[model samples]
Target: MTAIPLSWWVSVATALFVIGLYATLTRKNAIAVLIGLELMLNSANINFVAFNRYTTPNQVGGQIFAVFVIAIAAAEAAVALAIIIATYRRSATVDVEDIDSMKF
Candidate 1:
């Protein structure tokens, strides 16, 4: 089996990051925003792992950082979901604009 070039993974990671940014900015629903955030985080993780694999010196920094990122992402997801669920229960809506009650 032929191994795919490192550039391909980098390109894919960049694409995922861009798409996630767009989605996060354009999305109105809370769930969609969360998904975009998760996508961005995963893309970063892909980049870290790819770099670790491609590094000639085999430094453990990238892999260690990737693991840290994954742990943080998991915690973020858990907390975010809890907040979303609580907000939805109180407001009955997940739309970002609909939840804003403070007036300027």
Candidate 2:
């Protein structure tokens, strides 16, 4: 098996992050936005793990931060999903444009 270069992994992570950012910026669906957020978070996690693996002496700070990020993302997903549900109940739709009237 051929060994993969660390730069390749880092580049892949950067691509994922950029794509996720684009998706988050252009998508109108709340679920799609959440997916983009997840992709971005995972990309960051990949970077952390890759750096931790490649750097000599095994500095674990990156890995620790990645784990913390994962946990925080999970909590964010739960809370955001709850808010989405509440919004859907009130608006009867999940389209971002449909809820623009904030007078309610």
Candidate 3:
């Protein structure tokens, strides 16, 4: 079997990150932004694994870091969703631009 080069993985990660960036920028809904954030996190995780696999096969540092990122992402998602829900409850809409009650 032919081995895939590191550039391939890096390219994929870069593309995913860019897609996520676009989604985050263009989407107005809070949930859509959350999805974009997830995509970006996943892209970073992919890069971490790819580097670990190519650089140091024996050590599991990359995998460990990815796990930590996953944990942080989960927490962040929960907190963000809770805040979004609270905002929706107050403002009646999930649009990030529409919910501007916080502005003083």
By TM-score, the best candidate is: 3
**Cα-based lDDT for every prediction:** 0.89, 0.88, 0.94
- lDDT, residue 73, candidate 3: 99
Which tens-of-lDDT digit does each residue in 1-104 have in candidate 3?
Answer: 12899999999999999999999999999999999999999999999999999899889999999999999999999999999999899878999999876686
Candidate 1 to truth, TM: 0.88
What are the per-residue Cα lDDT tens digits for candidate 2 across 11-74? 9999999999998988888878899999999999999888887883357888898999999999
lDDT of 2 at 16: 99
Ranking by TM-score: 3, 1, 2
RMSD each, Å:
2.0, 2.3, 1.2
lDDT of 3 at 46: 97
Rank list by lDDT: 3, 1, 2
Using lDDT as the measure, the top candidate is: 3
Clashes of 1: 0
Which one wins by lDDT: 1 or 3? 3
Determine which window of 10 residues in candidate 1 has minimal summed lDDT.
51-60
